[model samples]
Target: MKNIIGAKLKAYRAKNGVSQFDLALKSKGKLSTSTTSTAETVTNYDPRLSTFIEMYRYVDTPFDELLTEMGYGESYQSTWYKRHKGNS
Candidate 1:
């Protein structure tokens, strides 16, 4: 895998004018500058579930839009919600 999520996150960061440092700061220890950089540039990056959530949440990226862009259909989205709901 080529880290599709990270690429989309980079695009979102650029679109929203948010720097890595800013994202890390905004995350309040949920994220870090190094982690953000690695996520954007590392081909083998495997981020945690919370990392994915916080990154997208920081840039206000819509979950449905991201899933669609990543080639996951609406079915998977609903399945994900069903499985993960109330866990957090």
Candidate 2:
């Protein structure tokens, strides 16, 4: 499957004139250059959930939108919610 999340991340950064290095910097150690790089360039990489959360928050995208864009159905959504809901 295509890495839609990565593509969206790249697009968000590009649209906002933010470089990967700057992204990491702006994140203030919540994210790293290597992490951003792998997410953007690694075709088959499945990033951790926290990474997704951080990136989504950083780019001001809604979590529901992210899950939807990833093509996850209701089951996955409920599971993800159950696992991460109160933890947020």
Candidate 3:
């Protein structure tokens, strides 16, 4: 799982044309470069929830889509997205 997510994160960063240091600075400490490196190297998989969200924002990807790709249940959007995004 860590390997999968790490690869995805590295891909996303590449797609956005940014390095890990740039990403961490852009996130304004919402996510750390160390954590980003961890995610990329398969050394750390459990990034903070806030860091995960920041990744979505940084990559210009929708959070719902990310959640789906993460293998969240089909009912997740219906059950959690609205509440999580304060749309409820």
Candidate 4:
């Protein structure tokens, strides 16, 4: 899951043509400086919900899009239904 979130963050940053440092700067004002720093600190960290929301605000991307872009397959809200759809 952390890897998925990291992949999404990296993809979004790439799509926007921004470096991690640039993202950190942008995120600082919208999210928290610590959150931004944590994101930039490693390549595989699960982002907090607030972090995703803040990133979406700054990048004009939806959380679902981000999740898809990161290869999450289904939205978090639909995970259980998606998982159990075939079983039921």
Question: Which is better, 3 or 4, measured by TM-score?
Answer: 3
Q: TM-scores of the models, in the given order?
A: 0.67, 0.73, 0.66, 0.45
Clashing pairs in 3: none
Give the least accurate 10-residue stretch of model 4, judged by summed lDDT: 1-10
For model 4, how does the per-residue alpha-carbon lDDT over 1-88 read when each residue is reduced to its tens digit? 5444544555677788977667767766565546655665666767767766665565545655656666675645476766675584
Q: Best candidate, TM-score-wise?
A: 2
Candidate 1, position 4, lDDT: 62
Q: Over 4 Å off in model 1, which ranges?
A: 75-88
Candidate ordering by lDDT (highest first): 2, 1, 3, 4
When sorted by TM-score, best at the front, the candidate numbers are 2, 1, 3, 4
lDDT of 4 at 44: 73
Score candidate 1 by lDDT: 0.75
Which has the better lDDT: candidate 1, or candidate 4?
Answer: 1
Model 1 Cα lDDT, one tens digit per residue, 1-88 = 3366778768878998888887777789788888888988998787888888877775445666666666675566667687885697
Local error of candidate 4 at residue 58 (angstroms): 1.0
| Model 1 alpha-carbon miss at residue 74, Å | 3.6
Off by over 4 Å in 3: 1-5, 77-88
> How high is the CA lDDT of each candidate model?
0.75, 0.75, 0.67, 0.61
Error of 4 at 44 (Å): 1.3
